[model samples]
Target chain A: MRRVSLLAMVVVAAPVFAGAVADLPSGRFAPLYGLDVGQTSFPVRAFRLDVRPVSRADFAAFLSEVPRWRQGAVPPALADARYLATFAASKNPAAPVTEVSYFAARAYCSWRHGRLPTTLEWEYAAAADETRRDASQDGDFVQRILDWYGQPAREGDLDGPGSPRNVYGVEALHGLVWEWTEDFNALFVTGDNRQDGDISKRFLCGAGATGSARREDYAAFMRYAMRSSLEARSVLPRLGFRCAYDDVGRSP
Target chain B: MRQLAFALCLVSLSAAAQGEPRSVLALETRWRTESGEQVSLSARKGRWYALSFVYTSCAGTCPLTTQKLKRLDATLAKAGKPLDVVVVSLDPEHDTPEAVKAYRARHQLTSAKRWSILVGEQEQLRTLTMLLDFKYSKNPESGVIMHDNAVFLVSPSGEVKATMSSLDGPLDEFVAAVPAPTKGS
Candidate 1:
């Protein structure tokens, strides 16, 4: 076993506990809000995210039974076919697939009778407060993340900060695999500037430009820059996604 | 003298045959270093370079990876085989040249020529990352960027020699895995 010491200077502040909410109804969307100065919101819908990322063992089970997973039949540009997580080899059967692609993730979602969350829906759920408004502002995202990072991450069990907590009554939102959304290309802006366009083309108006306005005014820009770094096809080691369902009550 | 010459020839031939340099498509993108000078991948190909993806605001594995790279750099220097260490920012939005400079200073990476930090346009970085098979994504709501953690070793001839995962490997193993610079190259 290789012993590696991390020089990360993180100060895990005492765990701040919030009041527990009622259990969210199945197939309903919930909001996971951030802690910042102004309004920042991500609306997360309620669906079971595989507790862990797709593991090697989970994938291997699929490989043995599913013909599509075999070598030469698997999708293009997938990482090494042999490496699996050590923890996954001994874990439960229903754990989340960790190192899978957007396509693979979609396949799994399809298999489970669920769909990937739309980008808007995903963001709305992720940024929503306890009441689904911007309790935390855009400017404070980095600090909140830093605060989260400072805390000791709970492992193994699925119900923690990233998992559906008993307190907030929502499922995995942060610190999990960067979840995939359905409408990954939708752009958002407030006031007169609100319009939808090609997210890639709007890079200039998006994040990376600096000003007080950039900080306070251009919330959409920040979101766009953040999402633009991702390739729709690639699956990162840290990237994992959850599934969402349409509101049947509203649709009918 | 004839035997010694024959042995030397055999060694050279084996070294040439054992090293298979894979051609990597290097993109030309301008990045400002801590010193405020513009730099690009094309300019650094003649020397062995170890490149890692990082953002200054990252509180998770980036710091660990940087510390490991710094250790590798120190080890290489002690072994008299120093190489260039380059950190390319995955989050160009927050990781400006000034911010990168502050990050370097925080980690005490002041040695000028051996280490260089860079930040550039997101598109160019995306292109470079694609070519290198590096994957990353950012949460639109929180601005948290998640990326694959791997250090890529590029040869002096602009070829990708090897890649090492940051989570579960010895730095010494990765250091030893790096192919030594060819003599008189």
Candidate 2:
């Protein structure tokens, strides 16, 4: 594969009985985007999330069993040109899979009896560190993630350091790959300061920072901007996803 | 040499046509028509149509979109295609049969048999929007919805033939994309 061996180095992940889903508690947090004009934080329900992104080996097996989702078999409307191109290039059994489109990711999660996490659910989990649950404001932590994001992608570069197990024991929330959220295309904000709606025009005038709860959270902004730039059929080399289960009420 | 060249040209043409018809019609959902009749995209497979999304209570741009569709319907009818325009309600939860009927009455579309209004759950709408690459979002508190001001033309085989912004742009190109009416009505 042009991406070399991602399944081996990208995120083997830690062994913390993380195989079982992590039951995240419900809470309200203002996202980088998607808040109403007068609203601050939207309510997030308690949901069970996979501790790590779905890996290449898991996807390879899925492709074998579900031939419809395999390369060339998927409809052009459901996946872009480069969908699953890496799977054809090389085989990395354990590293996380990349180049799966949002539709493909949803199909995969559905095959496992789960669904892609909502943007709020994903952001709520991703905003954590080793000690505190929401380390988004921590300068060093955010800087570390930003540094990783700044790096030019190189083959074999993805092999270690899976964003340090967060408070919820979920790893690779960042510093690995961008993920597909269930409502990734729900919001249609332009990359510039402009957002849709009459209220947004009035409220988000001049700088777009006022629209978000924390204007300082640039990392979340970048993520949201990246998501806004994508279509449901887009597939990228640095994109992967995990699943969330609504059936599991709370972690035991 | 002539036969070889002809065979190669035929190969290319066949290759271009060999793929699943990746269009909105492929997605399956039980959408209730304005008359409360359950129908899916497959029900509209025999003819070409214009597709767009709108809600009855939209205070902002839906009325303009509806007006544009009316013009587009007239232009196509004049062009002899008389393609039907199918509009799905983005706010399926609020747009019940009664609301759809009221919308038809308000728009003076009660007699326009060619215009079909389909109301389905948000789940199917989401799926169809993704396939069409159409964007839409509703603010829970404000009840304000932001959506793409777009319209699409679909072929009888269920593939999108052309697209244009409903809020702007002339219908000349979009009209040209619609297939001519087949023989025998």
Maximum-DockQ candidate: 2
Where model 1 places Cα greater than 4 Å from the true spot, the runs are A1-252, B1-26, B182-185
Which residue runs of candidate 2 sit more than 4 Å off their true CA positions?
A1-18, A88-91, A190-210, A250-252, B1-22
Clashes of each: 27, 4
Recovered native contacts, candidate 1 = 0.01
Tell me how far the alpha carbon of residue A2 in candidate 2 is from the true structure, in angstroms, after superposition. Answer: 15
DockQ, candidate no. 1: 0.02
RMSD of each: 20.4, 9.5
Which docking category, incorrect, acceptable, medium or high, applies to candidate 2?
A: incorrect
**Best TM-score goes to which candidate?**
2
| Alpha carbon deviation, residue A45, candidate 2 (Å) | 1.7
lDDT of each: 0.51, 0.75
